[model samples]
Target: MFTINNLLDIMVLVIFMNMQEKLTILADSAKYDASCSSSGSALKRHGDIGNTAYSGICHSFASDGRCISLLKILMTNCCIFDCKYCLNRKSNNIKRALFTPEEICEITINFYRRNYIEGLFLSSGIIKSPDYTMNLMIETISLLRHKYKFGGYIHAKAIPGASTYLLNKLGNLVDRLSANIELPTENGLKLLAPNKDTNKITKIMEYIKENKSQTFVPAGQSTQMIIGATKETDYEIMKRSSEMYHNYSLKRVFYSAYIPVNKDNLLPSLNLPPLKRENRLYQADWLMRFYHFKVNDLLNADNPNFNLLLDPKADWALRHLEEFPKEINTCSYNDLLKIPGIGVTSAKRIISSRKYFKISFNDLQKMGIVLKRAKYFIVCDGKYFVNNLCFNRSFIESNLVLEDNLLTSLKGEQLSLF
Candidate 1:
């Protein structure tokens, strides 16, 4: 009762349904990774379909605060490794899906045409072996680049233990690449992910660093580390971050608060993700990256962890009271950055404005400085901004803590219906 055309149409419909199911499963699986932020690549080529400079891909954010400008997904959710912290581990009873190279290219081209995405962020769980998975990823990107002519921003995850040959091929095809270190400490990795090798991970990073030319990984490499899953201190984590920056030339080290996905005996029994700890680490990372603060300056063996009440800069300022009341007009640019409320922009503004005219306390406010926090630490025109200010550590500490609490309370308050 059916013609050949009728049977072919039915087959196409079934394939479309299957593709939709794969997308739903894989996209949800990819959400746990926070290292997919895209920037620093202005990749545009002749005869290409898209550009990274189109609409500022970094500006787009999902409702839950994750970057969603890219068609972020996995090649497959089937893995051979059974990591304790991973949701897609082999032992977990979750829905799995795989996208073939052609399917990935088709999806990316369609998404780009619809203006739903400006880029592609592709990662995967290990299938068969690391090399096999890397090969699949490479093939997908190759099809996107050559066949589809997708010149948009593409970020790919380099599988650790995959050969340098594949690593080089993948790096050349994508805008940026990341190889997640998984855990901060080697011991934590051993306890949580017994199959992963720290040496192999570093080797991938090393290879990327050594072979990086102008056309190869123009956005460079980044990595992610899980926090609160191990017993490592903040000092240890920052120390490793510093080393990676200097030793391997890493662009960023993203910190993900370990959200417990599996209930293994070794995993922590966390009721919720350690979001606050993760925030503090990001602040400290900013200090190390932009403010040029060393690990020892922010923390040490004596005071290893960050204070939950005070931010890293504020806590550091409180510890070194001798450096307080820094004359805003006379302090070095480096010292200007040490002030709690003054960020990189305001600090540069302070330096540039002072060259033309002496900056007053009123000018600081106009420059978008947080006067409440900065007032206690800075002086303008050789006079204290706060009249008759007490320099006592406890007094200043209590004031900053009170201000933070008030701000948080205000933010959490809901508007009443009249």
Candidate 2:
């Protein structure tokens, strides 16, 4: 009953099936890497295929909250290491795929022409050795740059313990380079991912900084740490992060919430990833980098965990009430930033405009300050705006969470003052 037409259809279907399977396995394997931010480059393009400038690349987040849309994939998932936390670890019976250098180049070009992706985030599971794997990566990126003339953004991962020669080679060819820190502390590494160590990771980071003049890495270097996989406290993890930034000059440290892929007795038994913890860390990180907050300012030995209900800044403001009720009109720029509702923009605006006139409560609202939380921490023209509202921490915390018709209530408070 079979005919030549039916035979053609079957062969075509088989090809699609095979490619689909490879894409599925490799893409799923890549989800564990949490180092995918691509916004740090400043390269301009003339007539190149794409640019990492103005419209460099726009990021789209996956369902689980990792950045996607850069053709994020691994060169191969057939890793030699048997790190129990990894799904692609050896000894696990799973289908594997490897994209030849030619195939990878063609896929990148095709995707770019179709506007499907603006760049590539190429990572790989170790095939032979770290140097061998790094060379394979170098070849793919080299082909994309030289042969295909790809001028778009690229985020390359530096294999830990790879030869410095190979690492420097790839660094010249990519916009961003990252080596995963894997775990925050040394004890965490020994317990969960025994094959990895922080010493090797830090050495690579140190090397990149030393060789930046010779290598490109224009976007600077970054690293990643898995949260909640071990017993390290948030304080400990952030303290290490702070050290890395000051010591190694890292641009960013990405925190990925741990998802238990395999049941190892050494791992925590969780039904879902700790996304909230990950988010709080990011908020705290932002405070550190931009808001001029020190790690000690955010967390200490006694208070290690972030409050789930309120953000770190709000929580800190609530605990350190003596620092609050700061006069908006005359407080120093540094003090203006400490209030929960006031951000960098609002703080700058207050500093700029207060020279002309005495700013009132309404002026703060117009400056994009979040008054719902700021009202508790700031005073306008020696007048407390939330004078009628409860000043206790519990009342403010509950009101902030419930929102509780608070904005309208505050408006009423304003009307009564007249």
Which candidate number maximizes TM-score?
1
Which parts of model 1 have CA positions greater than 4 angstroms off? 1-17, 54-56, 413-418
lDDT of 1 by residue, 167-187 (tens): 989999988888889898889
Candidate 2 CA-lDDT value: 0.79
Cα lDDT of model 2 by residue, 1-418, tens digit: 2111223543453355466677787778987777666666776533258767533455575654444658888887767777778887776677666677887788888888887776888998886678988999999999888888888878888888799999889998988888888888988887877777778788889988877652378788888899998988899989989988988789888888899988888989998778778888888888899888998998999999888667899888888877767999999998988888788888999999999989889987777767877887777998887674566788777877666346547665211100
Report how far residue 299 has shifted in candidate 2, in Å: 1.6
Instruction: Assess the local accuracy of residue 315 in candidate 2 as a C-alpha lDDT between 0 and 100.
Output: 88
Cα displacement (angstroms), candidate 1, residue 96, comes to 1.1
lDDT of 1 at 32: 77
Model 1 TM-score on a 0 to 1 scale:
0.92
Report the alpha-carbon TM-score of model 2 versus the true structure: 0.89
| lDDT winner | 1
